[model samples]
Target: MVRLIAFDLEGTLVKSVSGWVELHKKFGTWEKGKEYAEAFFSGEIDYATWARLDASLWKGHTKDEILEWVNSVEYMDGAQELIEFLKKNGFKIAILSSGLMCLAKRVSEELGVDYVYANELIFDKAGRITGEVNPVVDFQGKGAILRKLKDELKPELSVAVGDGYNDISMFKEADVAIAINPHEGVEGDHNVESLYEVKEIIEELTRGQ
Candidate 1:
């Protein structure tokens, strides 16, 4: 019955706690960005404003520098293997993240995901960061997107997996929600210590009824 599996990026696909924080650290604004991140989470500022604030901190950075940071991201244990198994099993693999489009695109291609949804981090014609961002939606907006997908594709069974507070909304939208290396106290139908364990869950979910 399972036909779709959506994943979060920062902690789920990559080991980094926050892709935005990673970029901020690489570009020398991690500390300042933290305040904005807090505001974003508290609903004091919208995602577009938060994204632009992050971009503002990296104003002078170049595309190459950002890519260098993204390229250095380490994949979660068994992330590639899990992705392969999902594709092979005919699951519509989707990556839904509040992370930047640059990194999301790379992750989508690397994982061979069927759908990717992420916010755009803009760049100038000269390949320099533009200090602007095209916002998709808030972290909670992941649920909205997933709901839209369900309405359109109507997957017989849907699964959403993530590791942090932001994923709770999307998880609620899924028939089966999984938490991978979840933050303390986060709850889900399944709590897994590693991505490799997802294989077992998929097997159980997909086994013939």
Candidate 2:
């Protein structure tokens, strides 16, 4: 009955582990950059504030440089294979992420997923980072968008895969949730280390159905 499968774009789909951290490194925000994640997870800040903070880090960087950074990202091994497998198995695919839309859009288009919900970064006409962003999903709000997708796609069941604190909300809404190579204490119905294992998990879960 799992008809719709969703994937998180950062750690789960992109192999670099953290797209945000990559941004921080690229923008010279790593000095105090890691602190923002702690603030975000501790409820000290929301995604909007977090987005603004991120933008502040890249304010002087050019759009071309940012786009180059985004394009240089490497995807998770087996991501393309797993996506193709899901499609072949009759599941409509989705991407629910709090990550930047630039990379998510690229992955979704490459995989041809049915839907995607993610945030966007804004830039001024001069092509510089504006320190402003439009958020599509806040922390703990990923499920809200999934709920919206459910209403639109009308799937019988939903499956999700992720590997971060932000992804915890997705686990609650999915009929089947897999935490992929998670951080030390994150939880899910099942846990895995790779997208290859995810395919196996799904097959076993839906066997004989």
Candidate 3:
């Protein structure tokens, strides 16, 4: 009796493995971005500090320029179909990612998602990157966020689908955890190679409910 589905954005619904990394690569800041990512993963820096460091790389870029980059991101195969299938089956959909809000917001709007939570890069009055950030989702905080969402939404059961290490937290919070093309060692109640397979899994889960 699943009432909701939470999905990771990059590498789950979207083709990019990480929207932040892709943006950094596009802006020629990947070298520094990679270092910051390593530092964060190694426990040398907190998420806020890491996010600030990454945001600073795009300080002078205009919002429109960043939006252009965001627009370039493509959806994963069967993303649209999977979302539509979930919606049609009367399940609330949520996008929970540690990626940037620029891309997450677009995906939510385009797919008509019910909820979304992701980090945000602040902008100045002239719409330029401000070297600041609103770190709404921490790489290791998905479980806490999901628990909060569960309390607020009160879904009888919830499913989480993702592919990265960060998603492991969400998987723990969800009633049904699905690892979609997961990274090494990331396990879930079920493992799938594609979003199409996710549809079949959901269909089976919802058969009697």
Stretches of candidate 1 off by over 4 Å are none
Write one digit per residue (lDDT tens) for candidate 1, span 1-209.
44888898888988877778778777678889999989987989987888898888888689999888778888988988888888777789888888887888998998788889988878899998889988884768899988988887888989999998879999999999999989987878999988888789988898883
Ranking by lDDT: 3, 1, 2
- Candidate 2 weakest lDDT stretch, 10 residues: 14-23
Better of 1 and 2 by lDDT: 1
TM-score leader? 3
lDDT (Cα, tens digit) per residue for candidate 3, span 116-151 = 999999999999999999999998888888888888
Candidate 3 error regions (>4 Å): none
lDDT of 2 by residue, 89-133 (tens): 879888888878888888889889888888888888998878888
In angstroms, how far off is 143's CA in candidate 1?
0.5
- Candidate number with the higher TM-score (1 or 2): 1
**How many angstroms is residue 97 displaced in model 1 relative to the true structure, after the best TM-score fit?**
0.6
lDDT of 3: 0.91
Clashing pairs in 3: none
Could you tell me the TM-score of candidate 3? 0.96
Candidate 2 achieves a global lDDT of 0.82
TM-score of each: 0.94, 0.91, 0.96
